[model samples]
Target chain A: MINDNSEIILSVRDLRATVDGTEILKGLNLEVRAGEIHAIMGLNGSGKSTFSKVLAGHPDYEVTAGEIHFKGQDVLELDPHDRATAGIFLAFQYPLEIPGVSNRDFLRVAFNAHRKARGEDEIDVFDFDDLIEEKLDVVKMDASFLDRSVNEGFSGGEKKRNEILQMALLEPALSILDETDSGLDIDALKTVAGGVNQLANADNAVVLITHYQRLLDYIVPDFVHVMADGRIITTGGKDLAKQLESRGYEWVLEEFRAGVTA
Target chain B: MATVSDVSVLRTADQRDAYLKGLVQIAQAAVPENLALEEVRSRAASFLNEQTFPSTRQEDWRFTDLSAMLAIDFATTGEASVTEADIAELRLPETAGAQVVVVNGRVSRELSQLGSLPEGAVVGSLGDRPELQSQLADRLAQASGNHEVFTALNTVGFTDAVVVWLPRNQVVETPIQIIYVSQAQGDSLLVQPRCLVVAESGSALTLVEDYWGNSTATHFTNAVTELWLDANAQITHSRIEREGTGTFHIGKTVVTQARDSQYIGVAAGFGAKLARHNWEIYQTGEQTTTRIYGLGAISATQHADTHSLVALSHPHGIVEQEHKAIVDGKAHSVFNGRMAVAQKAQLTNASQLNRNLLLSDQARIDTKPQLEIVADNVKCAHGATVSQLQSDEIFYLQSRGISAPQAQRLLIYAFAMEILDRIPVETLRSRLAEAITQWP
Candidate 1:
């Protein structure tokens, strides 16, 4: 149970999710407090995407036995867009290519959808243009990029930056950046991290979902969680990320072996 | 009560003869023009006299057997007056410029609004312009000779047609919308409506032909539109054919793009018994571009056929087309898109693509995208795909709280917007969007 004054926005207890009758996230437990940036690192097939997708209410993942609470509400009952409107955002590792829908219009609809769910009036077209213009600067995207279809023929860095732009526009309470650093060059990584840093606030949190430790150097997560076998095996301060960066995941496996023998 | 009086007349061949005789009188009274129109009529009569009714033996008419469609023995509908309220009901969102209304195949002066046109703009029926009749008549003979009997019949029997002429450098601000509404009685009738659009050098104009029917009874509509783009002129044509369920329609458009000119044509078929639309874009000049796109949504026991061909006979010409069809129930849809690049068209870039989505197991579609490139230096490609909605997309949408019907609507609308977004008019786009919003 979470304490009354914990400032915890999301608390998952013994969360187990499955897909096609195969267990993916097995007994995973975590707590994310506001104002803290947490980085989840794991190897391939480690269920990193599945964990985040289960939280985002992806239909493919079936949560067999678990209790998920978001702002003290049962998140398991919410839909994908509802979970999003309820302040949980998942930047897809592989964004969907939706042709015919312009990037500007998609962002506008998503922004207003979240706003309307929060009892705010929808922004007019003129106001929306101005707002997008301001946010485009955060990702260093050109004005012409907004007129193109939503990630139809976007480059690798452009798609990641477009995700960040959407994250900045919607301003969700818990923004889970799923491999946002993947396929991004060093320059693009710094730009995307800078945009995330600007949106970090005391009332909102960010969870950086990635497999590489290199991205942690630029974003500098407050806490590092190493996941293995569909569950987080260790959690530590920022130095843990750097140690894993130098020695790799084998160091943690040695410690796990030694502890078991002891 | 009236059925008994016509029971004996329905069996003999005289029934068909009497109806044709009355139709001839209606055509002569409405369009007794100069010698050129007379020549067109005489040629059409000769073709009709030599040929029998269209049967299933014809390749194009195989699926849609027209024997029953022609069996509906009805007289030609005469001229009917419409009130202001009727005209207002047919209003499209964008109507600040030229609005011409043709009721029952004849242009209605009381329902038209051509006051906003510039001094040199011409907006009237083809019967009113005898000088341009010879020019159009000469072109029709050289172009695709009316091999299709229906087209030949329409050309020969056409009475009222809207003709728009834009002089040099005259930029029309608002789109010219021609509203065609048919109110046919229980009797079967054939109405041939034609439109001629000529754009001079450096001129720009938008034209829209909106077809509608108010009757619940069976009706047939045959329409054709011709466009001539001069040097450096640009024209955007949008045709929306939304007839009733019992309506049978055959609509064709032919456009000739000149040097440095651009032509974009889009045809949307929403409702009809059997709808066939052919778009032919011939680029006879250097550095001309033509873009064509069509979408057909057929349901119930309907059949829709759309054939388009882009001929690049000149150098440095470009053409692209994307056609799609969504068939449900037992309906069958066909899309034949062809692009031919001539030998001398060295720098032509031509492409054609047809994609179909079949909703039901019994629903069928035949999509053929052909590209014949005789030029060695040209780049041409053609592709076609026939498939169903991805189950993953449906599950994704359903996971977002959209129900099954709503998800289906979203996917279908998304499929349609692929072609609908190319429409240049904002008002027409929104109107089409609104029509899609309440998908049945």
Candidate 2:
């Protein structure tokens, strides 16, 4: 599905950002195209999550210098919701528990917001119910989750599935899944990965951020990236992920250090 | 700021006694010739003579300043006509036939729609039913409730009182509704509305008391409601205070629970320049249960206060209470919940919480959870919190494509819905929710 004629969904050049007066993402660059899956692998403090948040326009991350272009349109000036309605989706690392807002209501409001942005009429409750039920099937979710408050009492696995369900509903062109497989059991991870695979198409792309390579086994990525100290140190084909899996990250750090010295 | 300015507003002894004595005279003039009510009015009138207008100097009225009421002169309910169309929107379809409408504190028979009642169940004015009238002489205003100034004033001069009585083991199928509307003619009036409910052993019923101002005239509404639950009886009550902006409403709801009886009350206040609700519950028997939930949403210069007391006197008593306030603009909201566990009330379990959300920098909130537990074997927990909307919650909503302002509205709705959901009537719950969302 990697077509040379496909348009680029996301292009970040020299992105520098900070939070609470501390620089986190420093001089990072990346590019994502249509129908391609890229896995950004890093250690816990390698700034992978901060990169995803900055791309999604989180308020806390102040981009001091950089340019974010989505479909050749500058997105750094956009608000988080405006960016979301402009077809960029970020699955949070920890989904919030809204105690009184129903899941069905939340999903409908989100869907209608996207619809309004697209100049389409908002769907009624009955129609939205059918639409959400269909998307729930993509994540193997039960119908009872729609009646409860949004993520109020959900387990780790259920919250992940709910996020995926929202992604399936919004149908964004560029998706950033932030640690979607962290808290899931084997079965839940497979189900979540299966849903992502089902939604992948030639016109859409996904950027997966994870600390482990186990998720790449189910949803094969076209590129695997290794990040360190707020920069992507090295990137390679899918085989590099396997090599990094067998030979620990310290080996790559030493090799990187040698290359830098030479 | 308000405390400093209110220092000079305190009334002298002559002014206090004169203002209260004037109100007592107005109430006594409206008193009917019924012999059954004469004794109650006489006793309350004697008590009201020595009382005066409450000021900010008093402990109970510290955060509440009633000096503004000194400027207005209130009259009796003289020929005030309120048609059905005035209260059509306030009526709930759930209580279609089992409803009574009180206009200017007198029963408006033309507007009430009490279709039918069971053989032992009675729902109507207190004077119409002889059985309730006989019980009213002994049961009304019997509890040692809070704010004696207002309750005694209402008992002395209320024109008519609504009564709900259920015999032993007679469970009413339909919920009883009492719609109290106030309308002033020519001048400002004092709308004193009263209600009494008695549930015998093994009987159960749900009651809704709605206080709605039907006119734009400035008025003073003093309301009092007394509930009695015998052994094994249950009563669920919902009190809604959405008075007019020009009105000042002060109400008292007192309850007495017998052995094994349960009482659950949900009250919400949204309107009126100054509104206060004194809710008190007393336990007389063992194994009694009480649940209270309250909410007040105010903006602009409005002031809303709720003072609640739950006294557990018997063993194995249980209580749970939660009160919330949403204050915006320069408005003020107060909540003081007291839980008193006596020595005889062994093994009592009680918990209380008061949470306030200040939406503006100028808004004010005063909340206190007082626990006085003399019994060493009892379990009691109390807490209070004052905060604005969480930044993370708003961002979480915004991340989902909802705009910031809409996200704030959604969060406020969610915060208040916890108490609004306890309302038994579907129409009533939705209406109150809508009002909160539409609050300015």
Candidate 3:
């Protein structure tokens, strides 16, 4: 869904972040514009996920030296929830299981919180029910999931689909899918990726952080970036994901180190 | 109003132990005319003669310190000065016509709204109906744990009690309620509220005993409730304690279940400066079912303790118990669950668990599960857990646009709702849920 030269939704410059006082993302740079889907591919500990967490203002991920601007507003001063209301959604890699809270109640509360933040009238239970039932079709989820506890005893694929379902309901401008394809089977992955593809319009952008190229087939990306040593080493088109699939990440790391030394 | 001599008598109090003696003496002033009632009162008086206020050295009172109550020379008798309008909000709509109101331990006939009792069903004070007097003669103050200190204290002093007696195969469709509202008038008062319920064979009843108040002054309330269940009978009991601020509340719920009977109890506490509930259930019949659940949500220097015991004597019985507490600020909570399975109780299934949520660093929780099994072929399991809200769970909610405080409220509500949702009355459940929502 790449449109004409669109508005820049997010811009991160020299993003240096740490977790537990240990540096994870060092001098990372990323620029995401509206209507563009970017795929960040890397091996373990390469700081791709850290970049997403830091962008979302996670309490533990400290941004010691970085500049993150969402729609030209400084995101560092806002709280985590404020960042969410500002249209930055980070789909968790490992969704948490919360017992005793029904899925429908949790979604309703989340939706009402957003509405309250925008000074709009919050939707009641009956109206929200209609809205949620319509949104459930995007992820192909059964209505029974609405009554059960949030993510409790849910299958891995079910949990992944729930994350995408949230994306559909929220309609965020910048969605960071952190390994949304990790736990899904083929059918579930297709459904979840289709959800993401449908939500990405000319007004919003999507950032996918994954280790495999299988998800890229369902949701085509406008650009493919390889990350090494906490920074993007290479940026290319969709064919770059095919190249990384054929040749593993070792060659990219080797070339990155070679260039660093030279 | 207390006479000048009564004030002089209360000034004789020296220590906390002397405070107990003075209370027993003051409660002994009124004597029942019924010979059977007098005999029960004298028997409890003898038991209270050798008993004193429990100390921390005692195992039962280890975590609860009763010294705070000793500072007040409480009057055993006070003029109940409450109007029906004062208790309007405390009355439940579900128990409209079937509710009994007791102010300062005396039944207010003007305030009680008793529906038409079916044939052979009685709902009133001890002397409300003379025909059933003989039937309840030997049944008064005769439960297994009647000899306990506070239980004897209530027996020695309570002026009036709400009694519900049903004949064989009788069924009460409405949930009967006994509302005890406390108010410390003139001076610090000691109000002893008592209740007795007997469900005969093949009968079923749902009972709710609500202790409510909103006064800022302190009061001492010692409440005792006893239930006798016959074979093939079913009973559901809900005991809710929300005394006024700075009130010291000690309550006991004793039950004896016959064979093929079912008893379920849900005890919850929220609004006392210091509160303790002793729940004792005994299974005398085989093929019985018992479930006990408790919850305490307190904060701001309050202390709440619960002691429960389920003793199984017959074979083919089942029991399940769960206790939870949400302690915040400097508040402290204690839970002691004991399960005893005798040799005759073969093929029994029993399980108990205590879960606590500590919301502040200074808050304290002490929990213990004691199980004693004498039967070799029985199944018994018990466990306890004390925890703080998980950071990851809060972060998950915060990422969804909920503020940190609201996220915390949601998590705490979920934790406490695990037990509160099981309360049988819908309005009561929602009211308590709303209280938990607004709890600091």
Q: Give the number of the best model, judged by TM-score.
A: 3
Q: Measured by C-alpha RMSD in angstroms, how accurate is candidate 1?
A: 5.6
Ten contiguous residues with the weakest lDDT in model 1 chain B: B395-404
RMSD of each: 5.6, 2.9, 4.5
Query: Best to worst by TM-score, what's the order?
Result: 3, 2, 1
Candidate that scores best on DockQ: 3
lDDT by residue for model 3 over A166-241, one digit each (tens)?
Answer: 8898889999999999868999899999899889899999999999999999999999999987889989899989
List ranges where model 3 is wrong by over 4 Å.
Answer: B1-16, B30-36
In model 1, the Cα lDDT at residue B374 comes to 91
lDDT of the candidates, in the order given: 0.78, 0.88, 0.88
Candidate 3 per-residue lDDT, tens place, B338-420, comes to 88999999999998989999999999999989899999888888889999999888888888898889899999998888888
Chain B TM-score of candidate 3 stands at 0.94
lDDT of 2 at B126: 70
lDDT of 1 at A162: 89
Cα lDDT tens digits for candidate 2, B1-440: 54854664543546777888888888878877662476777788777776788878798899999988877788885687788779999889889899999988988889999996678687888756545565676688777772399999998888788988899999987888899988876757798999989999999999999999745668899999999999999999999998998889999999999999999999999888899999999999999999999999999999999999999999999999999999999999988898899999999989998989899999999987889999899988888999998877777777778888878898889889989999998999998888877776
Q: For model 2 chain B, where is the 10-residue window of minimal lDDT?
A: B4-13
Please give the distance, in angstroms, between residue B167's alpha carbon in candidate 3 and its true position after superposition.
2.0
lDDT of 1 by residue, A48-126 (tens): 8898888888777899998999888999998777888888888777776666667786677677767777799999999
- State candidate 2's DockQ: 0.70
Question: Is model 3 an incorrect, acceptable, medium or high docking prediction?
Answer: medium
